[model samples]
Target: MRGKAAVVTGAAFGIGRATARLFAAEGAQLVLTDVDRDGLEVLREELAKTGAEIRTVVGDVSVAEDAREMIAAAVEDFGRIDTLVANAGIIPLQTVLETTPEDWDKVMAVDGRGMFLTCKYAIEEMLRSDGGGSIVCLSSISGLAGQSGQAAYGPAKFVATGLTKHLAVEWAARGIRINAVAPGTIRTERVRQLADEPGGPEYLEAIEKLHPMARLGEPEEVAAAILFLASDDASFITGAVLPVDGGYLAQ
Candidate 1:
């Protein structure tokens, strides 16, 4: 990945941060973005010590203007974007009956529409480069199967999967590849917060047992999969939803 340029959104923490660090180690010039400005700064400093070329953008993915600027920054700094990881998202736990219209719209805007906009602009910039690029969207297991309380999040992610396939077909002849990664229960701060709540630990333990692996996944584990899809190794792969779910989706 030396001399390659990549952009990772929601890169302040969790899978996004893990992917940014891994990409940097592989010699890719990176542009990391997130709405969490403080976290982004801390992450920038931590990774900068590695002597990797890095840039940071503090903005929300739900806004089209911000998405455009992020892509523009990558091009302005690195001359072209080689890969894009549209990983910014929110997972609000709410049942169908409990979810409000506003919540549904918010989740869709960030998880579904945000991905569309990112791919839209990234493709535009990538077409201008010497060669085309790859794009990976962060989807979830809920997008594949029904979950107890993922009314809004699940449907929105399902749309992300669909978007990935659509773009892959529409742009394949143009040399751009698009795909998605559906992650299972990963051990992140968000998951930890749920587990710390009343009965949340027991609930999580039961869920863990349901997976054949009998363990929750790590953010870096998923990051590894995303990295592969973003690299030349996956040149032949497109419009595919690769599951990193510890066999949860298999069952």
Candidate 2:
């Protein structure tokens, strides 16, 4: 990834943060975007210690102008976009009965439309430069398999999963590779907070056992897989959804 210009949306924390660090270590110039300004600043400061060339865009991915600005930053600042990690998303664990119309819209806005807008603009930049690039979308196990309490989230991820394959086919002749990573339960900061909630510990324990590995995965673990898909290492691999799910999907 050395000398590559990469854009990672939702890059302030969790899988996005981990991916940014990994990308920097691999010597990629980065454009990181997220709604969390403070978190973005902290990440930028940390990466600066390593002399990583980075820019931050504090914006929501669901908004078209914001998505355009993010991709623009990469091209204007770095001169080209070599890869895009469309990692911006929101997960709402709710059943259809419990989900209100507003609830459903918010989830779809971030997880579904967010994926489309980011990919649409990023691919445009890639095509404009005539330098086809790689795109790694963040899908989830819910996108592949039916799960309890995924009424809203699962369908949104399905959008991500389907979009990945379609876009890959759309641009395959142009050298742009598009794929997705469907992760199982990962021990992100958000998940860690769950342990502090009532019944959260028991809930998580039960969830962990469902995985064949009987453990939650770390953000860095998923980040590694994202790196592989985003890099040339995954050349010739497109439209495939790789599961980073601790063998959960295997079962």
Candidate 3:
């Protein structure tokens, strides 16, 4: 990733944060974004200390203008967008009967529409530039398989999964690679919060056992997979939904 320019959405937390740090360490100039301004600033400062060229856009990825600006930042600040990690999302663990119309729309806005707008703009920019880029979308194990409590999130991720394949095929001849990583339950900040809820520990324990590995994955672990898909290491790979699950999908 040396000298490459990358954009990471949802960059203030979890897998996004880890990816930004890793990308910086690997010598990529970054445009990190998230709705969390304070968190984005803190990450920017941390990466700056390492001399990583960092710019930040604090906005919602679901908004078209904000999505465009993220891609614009890459081109404006670093000449071109070499990669994009479309990792911005919201998880709503609810049953179909329990999920309201509003709840479903909210999840779709970020996880589905957000993914679409980011990739749309990024691909447009890539087409305009001399070089084409790679895109890594954040799918989930719920996206790959049916799950009990992900009524809203599961379908949204299916958008991530489907979009990856469609775009990969659509743009492959044009030199832009698109793929997705469908992760099992990862121990991200959101999941940690769930662990503190009433009956949360028991709920998590039961969930953990469902994975063949009998454990939850770390954010860094998922980030590593994202890095591979975003980098030239995955040159021959496109339209593939790689699982970062702890053997959950295998089962």
Better of 1 and 3 by lDDT: 3
Clashing pairs in 3: none
* TM-score, cand. 3: 0.99
TM-score of each: 0.98, 0.99, 0.99
Question: For candidate 1, lDDT tens digit of each residue in 31-131?
Answer: 99999999999999999999989999988888999999888888999999989999999988889999999999999999988898888999999888849
Question: What is the lDDT, from 0 to 100, of the residue 200 in candidate 2?
Answer: 81
| Whole-model lDDT, model 3 | 0.94
lDDT for each residue of candidate 3 in 1-251, tens digit (9 for 90 to 100): 99999999999999999999999999999999999999999999988999999999999989999999999999999999999999999997899999999999999999999999999999999999958789999999999999998999999999999999999999999899999999999999999998789878987999999989989999999999999998998999999999999999887
Q: Report residue 70 deviation for candidate 2 (angstroms).
A: 0.3
- What digit string (tens of lDDT, one per residue) describes model 2 on residues 1-251? 99999999999999999999999999999999999999999999999999999999999999999999999999999998999999988876678999999999999999899889989999999999998899999999999999988899999999999999999999999999999999999999888888998878987999999999889999999999999999988999999999999899998
Question: RMSD, model 2, all Cα superposed?
Answer: 0.7
Model 3 stretches with alpha carbons more than 4 Å out:
none
Report each candidate's C-alpha RMSD, comma-separated, in the order given: 0.9, 0.7, 0.7
lDDT of each structure?
A: 0.92, 0.94, 0.94
